[model samples]
Target: PDMRAAEDAGARNAQLTKPPGALGRLEEVAIWYASWRGDPRPRIERPQVVVFAGNHGVTARGVSAFPAEVTAQMVGNFRAGGAAINQLAQAAGARMDVVALDLDRPTADFTEEPAMSEDEVVAALAAGWQAVDPEADLLVAGEMGIGNTTSAAALAAALFGGAGGDWVGRGTGVDDAGLARKAAVVDEGLALHPQAKDDPLEALRRLGGRELAAMAGALAAARAHRIPALLDGFICTAAAAVLEKASPGALDHCLAGHLSAEGAHGRLLQALGKAPLLDLGLRLGEGSGAALAMQVLKGALACHSGMSTFAEAGVSGG
Candidate 1:
């Protein structure tokens, strides 16, 4: 981040017509965005939303209510602009891209073995990194993969030293029995892949699905290019957590877009110290929540850049 730009934006915010802190977190959001964009008064001209889809072998363990085929079907829906993310992104004036990663070959069932080998994980990460647009000022990453919430839970438990029951949630509207089975599957994967607990990237490879790994890579790319990111729900947050665990402060350029209905999502956000911008009971995996939050960011920038200063408006005691 550009410290000079941040200071400039903060000074401008103080001079705005609004009373101090009247805008609340929106003021902070604008300044943070300015720092990443290297412009004291930045405008969100082009926001990009990427949704990566992959199938998970863990679905074979009945971890999710939906079938693995839904991953591919949803990818088709995304391409046809029929998914919720497509509508949200369109409303936000964002360009949307959907990448499906080897849907025909799902990851190995994590309960029985590592989800992905080193080469496979690397390839998935590269796909994510390459999917990012260099010209995009803002980025939002989403995911589509059946049983991926189990992968996310295992990854979180491995990274943060928690039990499976602590991180597991009822993904895809699974029943109580299915939820318990998901928890057991998570514990089994953790027990089988003990080495992942010591290595963050290894945890992603062993316990995360391709779309999750891709989301991690996309966020890393956003950080590298100095583009601010809006993080989605549990699966997306779990992916972002891998980057943070590998390198502290890796998520400094990112913001939690919203709080999802997923049981463990709030706990994960608390762990990351990210206060979400919205809480609409959203649990949809498509970048719908983040895309919706893009409008909030746009509103912040609009007010920050378009509002006149007290001096310009010839007002006193602004």
Candidate 2:
């Protein structure tokens, strides 16, 4: 991807916009993708949002403020176009797809059982990839799972070579005492899961739910086809990071949506060498933050296409 072309396009358009950098990160996003795609005249075509829902085993340890059933409830809300993510996706002119994998949903038959099998994970990922257009310009990966923060922390610790404490945080307003308990749960889960102690894919197999695995597969598919993706918060980014490690250059197609309230997000983004676009202190998953970031990308694409260069606009140069 030739980012230079996008930058040049952005610079050329600045004179045409009302004020320089007025759009802020929005301008940067458009230019970034333009350069990445080597298209000075970039367009954001058929943006898609994928929300993956699953249940987590670690939630049994009282890690999250919300119950596991909330996962399925939110999925139903998303399908009904009622969640915040749904609103954002609609506002951003994006098509939405909801994926419900039988990872560990509260009402699921295996709610109290272990994670999915390796074959089940592969199938989920395949479905996630199919949820979007193969030629779409961008992909957004969001998650809906109770106690997913625990899974994300463990996965980040394993993939980025850190401890669970490094990635674990007060998810959904867990107090200091709760944080300690969450960390302990993460530590124990990490110790017990063989995948968490070994290869990233194998680790995902052991600890990851349907949503995370599917996001990983979606990310991999996007990269294989040269399409860029936007990662929403900790869990989504963590899954994306796993996918990146699984296949080199996978991160090339991803943009860190924002700095999540989750503690592990920073270190995970750092490991990927990505700078987030927003810092709204968002902790609620379900792709809300990432959907907001899409607005910025849209503005950037507008700048690329709508803005005129100095020569074209007949503007005087200093």
Candidate 3:
């Protein structure tokens, strides 16, 4: 992020219709977009929501209420424009794309084996990078892997230096017992691949789902393309954690779209130094939070660029 643009935006905001700091986080939103874009009057258009769908072998542990096949099923639903993210994207006026990562190879159970090899992770990342259009104004990366929360929690624990159990969450409406089982599985996976604790890419290779790897890759590509990224919930944050580790300050191009209801999500966002745009107790991770926040960003950009200046409105100035 560019400090000069933010300072310039702050100066510009003070000259707008409202008093200084009256807009609160909306002002911050404008500043952030400006900082990323190096444009005091930044505008967002051509918003795209990319859903990365993959299967998680850990679902065999009965962690999630939905089965692994549901990952593929939801991809179909996303194509049909019937999923929650689809509806949210429609409301937000954003285009949505779904990518199925590693459909040929079955997902490895991280508790027993690496979730994806280095080659697989690299390939998935490349696919994610290619998915982002250079013309995209903003990119929102979402995940649809069953049991991905477990993979995400494991990645968080690995990068953040915590017990896997501490980062685990009930994904897809897992019950108390299912949550416990998910924690145990993540712990065991971490134990099996302990090197992930010190290496971020290693963590993704060992514990991250295909969707997560792709998410991380897409974020890296966004930074390269200078497009701001709006991240979803727990899963998205965890992937961002890995991206941050791989490339320092990578998340400077990203916005924490919302604070998920999952307990670990706050920790991940705090680690990433991001303040979410919305806090609606949203736990759904299919990029729904990001899509909704895109709407808020649109509002913020509109107010920042459209509101008349004090001089233009013939009003008093500070």
Best-performing candidate as measured by TM-score: 1
lDDT of 2 by residue, 134-190 (tens): 867778988898888887787787787656677789887788888888777667666
Q: Provide the clash count, candidate 2.
A: 3
Per-candidate TM-score against the hidden true structure: 0.99, 0.88, 0.96
**Candidate 1 residue-wise lDDT, 179-258, digit = tens:** 89988998999999999999999999999989999999999999999999999999999999999999999999999999
Lowest-lDDT window of 10 residues in candidate 1? 309-318
| lDDT of candidates 1 onward, in order | 0.94, 0.77, 0.88
Global fold similarity of model 1 (TM-score): 0.99
Query: Model 2 Cα displacement at 197 (Å)?
Result: 3.9
What are the clashing pairs of model 3? none
What's each prediction's clash count? 0, 3, 0
lDDT of 3: 0.88
lDDT-superior candidate, 1 or 3: 1
Global CA lDDT computed for model 1: 0.94
Of 1 and 3, the candidate ranking higher by TM-score = 1
